[model samples]
Target: MGSLAPDSMVRRVYRCMCGINPGLEAPTASAKTGAFAASGVSREQLVIFLADTLRGTAEERAPLIMAMSQCGTEAAAAVTCEQVAEFLRDLISTVIQIVVHRGRLQGWQPERMGDGSLGVKLLAEQMCSELKPSDQGFCDVSSLEDFIFRVSQISLYLEMLVAEGLNVSLSGRPTPTLLPPCRETPWKELRCLLDLPTIMFLAPQLPDRYSAPWRLVFSTQLHGESFTRMVAGLSKRGPTLLLLKDTKGHVFGGFASHAWEVKPQFQGDSRCFLFSVLPRLRVYTATGYNQHFMYLNQNQQTMPNGLGMGGQHSYFGLWLDNDFGRGHSRARPKCTTYGSPQLSGDEDFTLDSMEVWAVGKPPEPEEGEEGEGKRSILDVDPEVQAMMEMAGKTLHSQGLREPEEEQEQ
Candidate 1:
């Protein structure tokens, strides 16, 4: 970049990570409209900034931090923790700005991370908390390197999501430069209880199916406050996330990795998980202790009705009774399948709202979608189906076995 005297291309390309102050500052150029003041960043400084933000190793990035904290001073042997926090804040702000502008939703509408939700500042604090500081409250350089190493995880996701963003990490790093060729999420507008930061946090946790924007399939606000309506909306949709807000102001739910079925038996598989959003952010995935991952049964006199995830019949990690507007999250030690504590503010929580989002591309709708044939045991329990897929075994018996009478549940 330095060899070219007229770094005009860099100037044009570098604007607002959201698209602002148009360039990396140049020494001779008196433009206040670049990334920095006309005191100007030299080629070395630009290289350092790019290195620290993207592919550079932790050791390589540490000097840039020291330079930043000391503010061009070479006298200080090290920086104070307070200065470290300030430096982290500046970098975090710039990172988020770039991510919000050029990353995930580039051609799609970009949204600033929510202040109320988990975001850059909170992430910075969490990183700082991990540092081992000296009596002077000064973090050692090694500690800073460790912190940078941790930040690299976020960088990986950023690289995977943003067009020009990249990293040297990952056992087999993906080439994120290639644009996802698929059409943008089938939906036009996004409306839901989740904030942008919350969505960003959860998106990467999804298995391999990256690039599939979450599409809202059901919401109590959009549809009606009816459990039957939820069932109808979510029944055949592929992997989905169920979100609920309790009257006590807690938000929680679970991820079901396949179509939900109304059944007398436990369904779904290990990809299923229960999550809490508000009050705290946590996801409890399968412990492999139980195959009872997801259960959604309704209108059964003998068996418990309504939707439940994790735990046994009566005690569920998260449950929404078909009775509607009433639910509970119970765990003694923790929920068996997800290993989660009670999610609602109370053991049993009142329903404030409910929403369901289909996670990947919606499957092409099939003809004769309803009452097409007799129901099989595989239809009643999704775990068996999941197990079969994992074992790489064909369901040859599915076609051979005579279908049983659909159990009235």
Candidate 2:
């Protein structure tokens, strides 16, 4: 019964409505009850609005979704697919804007998350695919109502995006942690492949230990395009998320539950999953069909040399060949390991961009370990190192430091 938030938040909500109808006016009254009465919005409507947006069931949210799709127009008996797509587009844009403005960004560099239009389109198609469409290609009330009774991620997405985006607290139950903190990462530029909504979708699915701050160990933009360099970044880093963008702009990747090791055998647990973000937003988890969870092997003349997750050796659900920029996703009907479809636009995809983030807090320094010692400036960038060496610049620091021990592969 008590829905009175701070005055700033009250105004923010009011502005949201006003954005839809520029002619709407703020009520002269200041109190919640008084304002609702004066503004010509009923008390029951406000209660239902809070219920739907805050914690209502899918059935409770269906009506509001319809109304938002109508956009203040007269009651519609049915809404077209385009209407739902537009509604989703607005919701997604609002979530991104909230992340950019209200920021739990900490120190991670914020940049444009690329065009989100295709993601919205794919999301709409996925949602509508469940409905029994009307003769006129519209979603009637019965369609939406019946679909709501079943489990759906739509409600979850709405809640997480709004709650995390607005930075709202759910009384004493809310966790202070949102995205894992980005403190003390060695990388100067901590920009990444995850849009705020994409992170909101993927983060909660991870294990609890990953709630600690994340580290940016590899990025194709900063690190040279060498599979060896990528492997170097992957080694010793506990539990990592790898995101890649293909030439067609489809973005997808997989989670590694344990630190990566270059062995011929597959490694990782069922907690590992695959996710697609750019052209669609969906996660495909393990099916327990087989133990082919993860595979990574390099410098092998006998075995396939690259990184892979799910399915089988050459026919992987997700694969990145050691050739660096070229790879294939060979899931036909579905990937047996995670039940995921081919994620890339094509089976043979060209890598446009890639990044890796190590989850959990960095290990505490060993006794007398003194300085954690910075990595070489060119450790990730071999081409840059060669260019600097060719320019006749002396790397006096390399000689002065203690020779580093080689890590066990």
Candidate 3:
């Protein structure tokens, strides 16, 4: 019958009403009320709740706007306007942050600032009115168009907001220059200009009078279905030829060969073939193949011996000659050649000559393989030949020669 403590009395009152021990309950209501009080919502909450309810009932923007405008009490309008102004300020700040980040505009330059013209002053006025700052007042200026345009380039939403505030019509046309100047040029463009496609196209052609001792180094790593498809494609495009350089014993020699092989089993409806190399892992092609190989061998570093009927050699030549000796060449079985040589257990050997062949001619017809009136596989295509001639002329005008032309003695 003794009087209960304040906490126990509150619990007893709660339990009596809800038929549950209030002592076991979480302080959810108290926490919510505390937050609401901290935010000074005691007077504004009812007004906001009523305004929200009225807003929900309205089907169109006209009714909602009219209701807000016609609110009876000054306190209601003030609260609602304050909330709207805060929302607009937050939205504007977020948009500005996004624009700055995407445009990569870190520091401001005074030179780039637009003078406070009539258009800019008007925009500032609208922004200030919407944000309702106490100390800072909005101004009107003529440079608003430039500001709106720059921000628009970064974010369409920001553009729309600015347009709405300025009461201007927006066209869908894209203005690339309107973007901040930071993204005008990208690093990738320079890289693409120097890529393989550009280099091959720009390379000079070998002169008809010059017969250079040249070797093609086609270094590649293609295998499985992809290799077969590429080989087949290359074969159909033109004659398939394999230039093999073998060094070492016949059983365990280094074999590097390039061929356009065909694979009929590809799933795609279009016939797919590829240009491939045997011992498929060690083949590459490019404009710099021969020069790179020669440089490596001359330096006595381990490299591929890519000399085609010439004196070019790889770093691995010495080791192969010593350990594997010379093996029969695929092109000329009578001529023994050393394949790619390597230093025994040397990891410093670099394969700089590994690249795809930029240019290749068809092979001459063998003596017994000729058919009546059939052109040899080695016969040059008239179109291809003409293109090569044109390319050579262009290169001559540019004072450059094909890599093969440079090797001519």
Tens digits of lDDT, candidate 3, 1-409: 0121223222222221221112422111112211222333232333332232222222211122222222222211122333333333333333333334345232222123222122222222333333332233321111222223332221343333233322344466442121112111223311111121111111212221112112222222221223222233333222112222222211111212233222211111111111112222121222222321111111123433222221133222212221112322221211112223222122222221122221233355567764334642223355754676777743232234222223247
Cα deviation at 68, candidate 3, in Å, is 12
Over 4 Å off, model 1: 1-42, 62-96, 99-139, 143-152, 156-191, 367-409
Better of 1 and 3 by lDDT: 1
Best candidate (score: lDDT): 2
Name the 10 consecutive residues with the lowest summed lDDT in model 2: 21-30
Worst 10-residue lDDT window, candidate 1: 12-21
List the candidate numbers ranked by lDDT, top first: 2, 1, 3
> Residue pairs in steric clash, candidate 2?
none
Q: Whose TM-score is higher: candidate 1's or candidate 2's?
A: 2
Model 3 TM-score on a 0 to 1 scale:
0.18
For model 1, residues 62-94, the per-residue Cα lDDT tens digits are 544544444322324466777666555544444
Error of 2 at 288 (Å): 2.1
Q: By TM-score, how accurate is candidate 2?
A: 0.69
The CA lDDT of each predicted structure is 0.64, 0.68, 0.25
Cα deviation of 254 in candidate 2 (Å)? 1.2
Regions of candidate 3 where Cα sits further than 4 Å from its true position: 1-85, 100-124, 128-179, 183-391, 394-396, 399-409
Error of 1 at 337 (Å): 1.5
Query: How many pairs of residues in model 1 come into backbone collision?
Result: 2
